[model samples]
Target chain A: QQQVKQSPQSLIVQKGGISIINCAYENTAFDYFPWYQQFPGKGPALLIAIRPDVSEKKEGRFTISFNKSAKQFSLHIMDSQPGDSATYFCAATENSGYSTLTFGKGTMLLVSP
Target chain B: DAGVTQSPTHLIKTRGQQVTLRCSPKSGHDTVSWYQQALGQGPQFIFQYYEEEERQRGNFPDRFSGHQFPNYSSELNVNALLLGDSALYLCASSLTPGKPQHFGDGTRLSIL
Candidate 1:
């Protein structure tokens, strides 16, 4: 019940296109959802985040579409560029408790120019 | 303000050896969390420290322990290590609970 399941282990998208990655979670205690982006040999960086109260949140060209009822969430990158190619991870954390994050396996997105 | 910073960048150890990784949290941040990221896998929570005490821990064994100083610096110690322990150790810091965390480059541990 603490795991976040992310899909599309790897994806290839063309430049100026849209890239999407999906994640489903099992733990209902989670109230916070976030997406992270990582380049080679670098730590994961916070891309965007959302809460159960809101269905969607956008930052720049990145957006998080959340489904509280379905326990699912996804990340959409508009105008995907080569620099956007990186490993993306979806994660969740409960409002209370230790505030530890539960992360999915990860998705490697490759944008071809 | 400086973000989370980890020391040694990389380390190598053999079986039965012990390793210690250090972390300096971002300025004005009081919480520090440690994670282990195996190849092709996302970072897994190890533990968290606040106010110089370990507030929470994950599923790791007792061989994995930690300490936090009054200055908000933290250390992760792994004893009796095995080859399977090889992975990237990441340090993340946040200003408040439920807020986004900032990560350091990470310390790569290679066990032989």
Candidate 2:
């Protein structure tokens, strides 16, 4: 079973527009939610993360909005740029970041110049 | 400081052969974790090593094994390889078992 489910397998957005991706989880044991960005032929890089205690966390133009009660979270990128085009993955883990990660399939985002 | 580094960036093997991949963790890191990522799919955890011992494992089989040296470097060994084993193997390291992990470019293994 896929513990974490992500939506919009792929997305396309214009430069400077808002880009959003959604995810839902079934395991209440999950307390840490992290987003990763991966370019082709490279490893996934940490982007932003949030814990159940917070409803939202923002860094630069990337933001993660988490809902513990609803078991859902979303990533919103403000003013998307061409450089932002890449594959994004949302992952969840237990034991406060000490455990193995359960990842969603991933979303391929494209920002048109 | 150097980030996680993996050796033998690419390899090709036929079925029934065995292969070993190596990894050197980032500076000051002591824990190593391995993952397998198939084409067009997200990476799946293989196992993790800390203090020269296997601390956690995913749902992989015995064919997949690993070792951690005292210096914090790690190696992944696969025995009786199959075509289905073809994938990009990743190595991630953290200062401790629970800290944020830094990943390497990964070793691409193709089985014929």
Candidate 3:
């Protein structure tokens, strides 16, 4: 079962534009939501994460706006640049060891110069 | 310190063959989990090992198994490989149960 669902399988934006990716989950037990960015040949790197307790978390150009009641969260990248063009994955995990993370299919974001 | 490290960045094997992939967790991390990512798909969990034992597993076949060593390093072994087994195998590490995980570059395995 796909515990989390993401929208816009792919995206393209102009430089300096706002890039948004949305995700929704059916499992309310999920407490930790994290976003990852992956290059073509590398692994996914942690971007920003938000716990259900918080409605929003921001770091630099990345922000996670979470809505606990709606079971949804979205990643926003401000001033999107060419470097920001990569695949983004939103994942949910409740606890640590022995547990698995539920991830969305991923969004391939391309920022044009 | 080095983050999670995986060996043999890329490999190719024939059907019916067996292969072993290895992973060394990041410094201060104690748990290891394995994931498989097919083309254009998100990663799927296989199993997780902590304290030298597999504590949880996903819906995979018996052919996929793993082990954790005393040093928190782990190995994933796939037996009787099939063409469908071709994918990128990833290893994620965390300090303990329920923490956010850090991932390795992954090993791309192609079955012929």
Candidate 4:
């Protein structure tokens, strides 16, 4: 079973526009949600994360909006830039146990200038 | 301090052969996790090691095993490799299990 599901296998956005990626999870046990960005020939890097306790968390131009009751979350990038083009993965894990992250299939985002 | 470091950026192995990939965690980190990422797919967790012991494991087979040394370095060994095993192997390190992990560039393994 895929614990987490992400939408839009691929997305194209104009530079300076808002880019959004959506994710829904099946396991209500999951309390931590994190997004990772991966570049070619590199490993995935932590982008932004949000805990279920907060409805929204923002850092700089990146924001994570979470809905616990809906078991859904979304990542919103403001002022998307060409440099932001990369594959994004949304993951979730139950905080009570070991940190085994269940990830989504991944979404490839392209921000064109 | 150096981030998570993995060796042998790439490797080629024939079916039925065996291979080992190594990883050194970032400074002061204590936990190491291994993941396998197939083409066009997100990473799949293999297992995690903490305090030189396997703490958590995913749904992979016994052919995939790992070890963690006192220095907080780890090794992943795959036995009787199959063509389907070809993928990018990634290593991530964190101060604690389940925290935000720092990843290495990864080792690309191709099975012939």
Please provide TM-scores, in order, for all candidate models, with all chains considered together: 0.97, 0.99, 0.97, 0.98
Candidate 1, B66: how far from true, in Å?
A: 0.4
lDDT of each: 0.92, 0.95, 0.92, 0.94
Better of 1 and 3 by lDDT: 3
lDDT for each residue of candidate 4 in B1-112, tens digit (9 for 90 to 100): 8999999999999999999999999999999999999999999999999999999999999999999999999999999999999999999999888668889999999999
lDDT of 2 by residue, A46-92 (tens): 89999999999999999999988889999999999999999999999
Q: Tens-digit lDDT track for model 2 on B1-112?
A: 8999998999999999999999999999999999999988888999999999999999999999999999999999999999999999999999998788888999999999
| Cα lDDT of model 1 by residue, B1-112, tens digit | 6788999899999999999999999998889999999999999999998888888899999999999899989999999999999999999998865557899999999998
**Which residue pairs show backbone clashes in model 2?**
none
RMSD of 3: 1.2
Q: List the residue pairs that clash in candidate 3.
A: A95-B98, A96-B97, A96-B98, A96-B99, A97-B97, A97-B98
Model 1: share of real contacts kept: 0.72
**DockQ class, candidate 1:** medium
What is each candidate's fraction of native interface contacts (fnat)? 0.72, 0.72, 0.68, 0.79
Candidate 1 residue B51 Cα shift, in angstroms, is 0.7
For residues A41-99, what per-residue lDDT tens digits would candidate 1 score against the true structure?
A: 99999888888988999999999999888989999999999999999999989974247
Candidate 2 falls in which docking quality class?
Answer: high
lDDT of 4 by residue, A20-59 (tens): 9999999989988989999999999999989898999999
In model 4, which residue pairs have backbone atoms overlapping below 3 Å?
Answer: A99-B98
Error of 1 at B69 (Å): 0.4
| Chain A TM-score values, per prediction | 0.95, 0.99, 0.96, 0.97
lDDT of 2 at B85: 98
Off by over 4 Å in 2: none
